[model samples]
Target: MSPTFPARRRGKARVGAALGVSATLLAAFGTAGSAQATSATVRHGVFPTVSGAAQIRANAVGQASSDETLSYGGGIDGIGVMSGQPKVYLVFYGSQWGTQTTDANGNLKFSNDAKGGAPVAQMMFKGIGTGSEAWSGTMTQYCDGPLVSTGATSCPSGAAHVPYPTGGVLAGVWYDNSAKSPRAASGHQLGAEALKAAHHFGNTTPASNRYAYYVILSPHNTNPDHYQNAYCAWHDYNGDTTLTGGAVASDVGDFAFSNQPYNMDSGAGCGVNFLNSGSAGTLDGWTITLGHEYSETITDQNPAGGWTNNIAGSPYQGQENADECAWLKGVTGGVGNVTMGNGTYTEQGSWSNDTDQCALTHSTVS
Candidate 1:
């Protein structure tokens, strides 16, 4: 069936509470810092570029304090978070990836991956559920259940909370090389690809996809949704109608996915050397970008359906957990390297409601 684009909710033409870029930054980046919601489908969890993050910091320079806390958006589809064990599927979209090979660490590698990002991504997922990693623990603080009221800032006792990927979140990885990925794939096209991936992984029902998410990784040189020009990456669901192509008709249910472009394509604008310097930091942006999306997906699996800032007239009104702390460094809960079972990776902090701060580390919830 052809995908349908419906006008469910009006999407913003630019990034709002997420990027936190002021008017000056918006003009400088020319919409690069925000996602364009040309249609009615709201684009949620948009990750900004380095310049956008800098603008967020600059906007807060003189402020004595700011409220970045998140409140529930009243569950959408009766779902607030990935309350179950989250399963992440990596889909290498397009034939441009060239030949695929396995690295010594058993991670997938591709000859066309100029920056050696494929394996790094695989390893990052593998390491997430291992080694008592506390990064994922930060998200455990948010929850969705009957006991928790809508717009509640903190999860009440017994509220169904987001579970840590105890074993691991990396469920499967596939290379969809059936066709060349569009040079500039639309939001609908990306959603369609994710649906294709769902079918490929045998997740053909809503229950099977309740906690599943697909990361649509574009080829190295291509710019999926013109991300290279505006933002680094963004996360949304198949149900969002504002997608460039349209909202995908998913018989399996509304699935969450992220448009993970080759971050190396945008250099510092996408996080190349934002954390570290020299060869050691080449893939710094890669992990941070993907991690940012992953954190948002599990928490806000259905966009605003989960935990997000819904406070009226606040600077972070619509931002998600990770959006509250994007690109911050050298402070509490800023960007830094995290040790996982697989290896150490650089990642950004996520918003924690319990502590009412951006937490880089938190005690495991369950």
Candidate 2:
């Protein structure tokens, strides 16, 4: 995740760094600079993870390509993607996630979730907008309006896109055992527990959190902000002042969040078998790390404003759209098993500026 460097407008600068895979082995994931804000400007978007011999030496030296693809980092308060009807709440954070129940296909069960992973993350967010799911149709072709033009990688005719979650973006779920989560919980206490889950899901306002999102989750063996040494999840909004107990003000406008730890406790370096193996791939890094921070908080919700890879010196500058297909496996839109309507999980594959690449399904743009 952490790459985005340039910023002077919509609070951009996320510098946790280390993800171009090979500048001396990505300098062993080093780089950290963020924590100077007088009026707040630190947006952050990081989901980095690369061990296992740095992912086999970054797949034998052939993975540094980000010439110029994703764009449109123009809207902040006006928001960018998740243009409409995309919700996902799921809080769960604390009391070590014990005692909660409902199974029998009603979903949302707990009892310390040994690895059941909270009903497979509520049936993968109720099987993401059901059967015709083209993997959420590759983010309905990226968008934002007002005539789209701040780095615009594409998206013009009528703009305001990113829809497709027709009936499932799991708009609710909470546990908040309320006082056991912070084993490592920083990032402004996970943005103040996502503004206390937007006042416990009433969704305060800013039009009920403009296409909301707030997965804080974090229990089973805990580690919220350090995310088990670096990141297996990341996404921000409470106006990221380099979070770690900094930003997080929100009077109910800048929402969007994520920090979702508990990726089966980082096994297999955060993707358990990378794609499917014995035991049907134990949660496969919990739905590919929560569907890669839920498609980067519905297309850069409030970090870098929306959509990224501004190309300043391009090494996938501040990546987004599932960080340009993280953890690629088989090929052709990497990582597999997408199925959707209530089963077959293992996801990974996003970033498709009209088929420029990395698009496991795509074909819904509108």
Candidate 3:
């Protein structure tokens, strides 16, 4: 069957919350400090760059006061890890994508690299779950929440904290040749497409996708949700809305999906990493957005049920783990190289309530 558009998220665009930039750290990296996860000294080989531990620790230390102290926005869910490990499946939603090329490491590349293609995202996801990377390990604090509840802060006696994402599988990739282009697609349609991808990959059962998420990458030049005007990209589970998609409110279980826009908006607007500027940074930004959505999905697979703050008057209430620190970088600390297996790509840092700060390098997995 052809892909169908789901209902709009809120009749209009839902803007992502803008975060205040950190001046203290940015000055540390300097102007030329802006670069992808790969190190300046090394060309393309997998060499570990500076973990930025010193900078992150120093930054956290300075914020020791309540004025700077940071804590998890809300309660944590003890299911810490995604059951087994972190697993991801890439779904190229439209046929507009051109030929596919394979890299030396058996990863797939795409002709539409600028439009948030496979090449950019592959490198980002490659080494994420491995090596107890900072981004993944930062989520350890969330494991300390209650066993089951909407707004949990402390874990019940004998309960476990949310485990960090140690390592996992890339799962696989599937380009929906049968599905039509997703130009001007609605949010509901995006959810439907995710369900289709799940079925196509034989991940129909919840067990197969317990800790899995479907990333729907739209072709370049398409506006998934007014990308240039409203928000870069957003993550949410299926059946959350009453849109006219395949999965209705009566759907069996929650299905996590992210509407990744075409890189046309480039790095600045949509979170792509075009070396912090220009159209060329499409892949980098795409990977950044992917990591953001991926992090949120693992922590809050079903949105608020996972780990979200709902306290009144709290600035972060209703925000997920990644949402709290979205687009906010630590300059010398935010962006860094993560050597998963063989690839390293510069991705953004997530909120670490444990340290009450945002860090690019997490020394301990907890």
Candidate 4:
């Protein structure tokens, strides 16, 4: 099959929230930071230009409270942090995605329809030539509110980008594998050791169709009714009044995984659900993780790319992540930074078709 997604923005575009940026921190990141998880970095080398982290803060618009704080260490998710035209394997579990199919390589198999009738969680993520890097990263205290809900009711101030997985981190059986079972319970991603093992077993390759599973549970999970509306349940469940263990949907089918860490019954290590430990997971964390690993693939494939852009604006209010100025643009500009609730400002630069890297004239993705 082909990797042709509908490209429609169904879920609300998440607003920037609770992310802090600093020059010192970003400078030490995967790129200029000098760390290569795979040969991709060693091959092209790491980016060596920019330094420090950009500030990102979403302010109080109308619905949210004026007293919420969010901080995120960039690269929260193990996203490879590359820079290239990388393709994320989006394993959707529902009739819409069809049934399980295999490629000639046998490296990546697919079963779009998840077991248990629920909407199969979308498992689209950045990839490395060898394996996957994700996050157990934090989202503590940086959400605007719920975007869509089945029956969620937490008092939130803004619109949420990703909703809680009603199915929990454990997406489905046949088609969609449970991302929660990875060795690194936090990122729910396959670590360096685990990836080599999968390679040894010939279960995967370093080319097309690499899938990274991310969790977006139902409203009940995000502690619906709580202030942050976060998912505080994983093991014993948190004592929030809005807590709903939730039901498993029956619609899932061929997309289930029998593999460890990817399968529940297969003895795979389940996720720790950082929320269970009491934290306000931010949308910024999830988004940044996705973006970081994404850019890495298309660029230098490692920390050797010429990341790091020049500065432009000053911080908005007192918020660190908020009120950032735009500098780098496109592939060369760099890939880091955060934004406020409003996108007037952004952290780190991204590959915007609107303009080239480091272009002063910004254009909307229209």
Candidate 5:
């Protein structure tokens, strides 16, 4: 994601900016008890060694007029819902953005910020990862593959399709407005498109996930500059204030089960270009931003939704940069704060169920 620089003080890395290996936990079976979960699910791992954890004490990331740092400095921390297996959003057949919610105080609520002159509402849908991927549940290491970031479009020849653990259902769909097309209309329009795609799933689920995860793909952002879509502002506080897209690549199609944030303010799929130095086809930035955003949003809808504006301090567990890719190792073994292909600087932070691609001990709130 883009560094909220110029707004940076104290100078630490942005959350999930470094790149490296996944922390391996030793278990009786050689992995955490959650390893090789009994389900037919495939397993994906995350990278964390490339970056170091951040001090994350509110005053670090960005400052305010009153001398306070941004409360929600990006990354998964203090979310309201952090239970069971990790879950995300999937677009619905009849609507978009899923549903919006409120916080503990119930003062801050989710509202629709219009786009293209049309009005709308932003909601939180739930989703999960497919267990039986073509890689046989143990596939990691994605490179510059067209199918990699393309989702169902680039599902290679024999990619398997799996679902989230437990009651995980295809609750909604997400849109994939990559570099262009369906830009301003990303929000609701994207939701509508996803619903259309679900019709193609053809009898996948009758109990749940009966819909497909609709998505759209933009090769290059039509609004690379924040001139048009606020999604371009990514890191700016005002960024979220921009017109919310009614769509995303996730919406162009539908899956048996998909993923999205659990809460309304769930800021998934938006960030500065941090992968391969902002490569066009990398999921690093997408996954990292979406993972952390949804992770925290689902946990604490208000505070978790990046609502507090000053609630910093997300202790990261894994080692990945905002680019959303794995960090294997640098010559030095570990990195603190580093810039990516875009010349933007970011702080390093921990990981959690923020990402469903990997095996996270997904936690939820009461």
Candidate 6:
């Protein structure tokens, strides 16, 4: 992820330039309950400007004729999905998010007093796992290999297939008031706060957190770890120092997290591009960005060690699957609005190595 240095703030470290560790290291030090997660590649998209948009469009990675895969020397073992029932927990990190309610389908709904994007995020997470949505299956095409940097194409025999989150769970929600505001919460601070919530929910051990990820949301009107400028949102495990104020690799487990602010502050910069429908407060971008991070987390749970391209000098390299297809909309294998059981959502496509294309739907896991 490139850093968005605010014009007024000249010397601060760009939040996108944070240090990242490997899942192998986390495995060496993490306890059983704290294990499953590993350090992930911090893939992020820059805020789009007219000139920037033109440049990115010219250089953007287009859909491939078949699934794409990087060589083994690039990182670690191959990348794979959660391979189990996935789980997600939502954290409203500040008081800015007010009360919450439950909709008819047992999905969490926030009060109107809260930012309009909040409830939409909640519903998208819930609705995506149901109705046999094809959006998610787009991720199943990726698989992990047993050897590091070997360029071995096939997954090891008996390797777990990227299971569809058939019965994915929205384990719980927490409104933490301790932060009170996102004005100064650093990336590390956000990870620590997520740890606090994990502790509160007894999700501390790796076994307890298997296939589980935490999403830390900053409120509107404030910034968390430079979100307004540097990047819209990002997903990473604990212990990645590359991010300013991130947890130390040795001290934390393989817990995954993403810090996002309400996108109204900077539309394309904060992930409200393409199908934003010309509304600053629209939930389309919010849900799409969230889905992007979620898909990346499960596939590249520990960053490059999972699945990532490592081409030199190419922004697209080292990018997770979703990053490759970030803003490609309306073309074959690009972004489009799809109807789920709850409602229609404008989401982007994910890269699939199987067909060597970016696809919105996968008839089967392959």
Alpha-carbon lDDT, every model: 0.79, 0.71, 0.52, 0.21, 0.24, 0.57
> TM-score of the candidate numbered 4?
0.25
- lDDT over C-alpha atoms for residue 25 of model 2: 19
Residue-wise C-alpha lDDT for candidate 3, range 1-366, written one tens digit per residue: 000112212211121222222332222222223332111110000011122223323454434322322223232222323434656788887777767768776766667654535765766676676765566766555543344343345335554444555554467787776756666776578888888877777776666666677888888777664444334566666755533233443132456677777755543444554345565454565666677678766665654445554343333334455554545554533655555654666566766655665666665443
lDDT of 3 at 32: 20
TM-score of each: 0.90, 0.32, 0.71, 0.25, 0.29, 0.77
For lDDT, the strongest prediction is 1
The better-scoring model by TM-score among 3 and 5 is 3
Which ranking of candidates, highest lDDT first? 1, 2, 6, 3, 5, 4
Error of 5 at 208 (Å): 2.5
Candidate 6 per-residue lDDT over residues 280-316, each given as its tens digit: 3266667777888888877766444456544333435
Say which prediction, candidate 3 or candidate 4, comes out ahead on lDDT: 3
Superposed on all Cα atoms, the candidates' RMSDs to the truth, in angstroms, are 4.3, 19.9, 10.5, 20.4, 19.7, 8.9
**Model 4 alpha-carbon drift over 4 Å, by segment:** 1-23, 26-85, 89-190, 193-285, 305-366
Model 1: weakest 10-residue lDDT segment is: 1-10
- Using lDDT as the yardstick, the better of models 2 and 4 is 2
Which scores better on lDDT, 5 or 6?
6
Residue 122, candidate 5: Cα error in Å is 25
> lDDT per residue, candidate 4, 1-366, as tens digits?
000111100111111122222223222223322222211111111111212122122221231221222111121112112211223232222223344465442323344323211221122221121121111111111121123121121213453212211121321223333232222222112122223233333435333212222222212111111112111111100111111222112111101110111121111011111112222222222333233333322221211111211121212211121112122234344323332221211123332212221212232110
Clashes of each: 2, 3, 21, 93, 107, 25
Q: Which ten residues in a row have the lowest lDDT in candidate 2?
A: 31-40
Better model by lDDT: candidate 3 vs candidate 5: 3
Q: Candidate 2: what lDDT?
A: 0.71
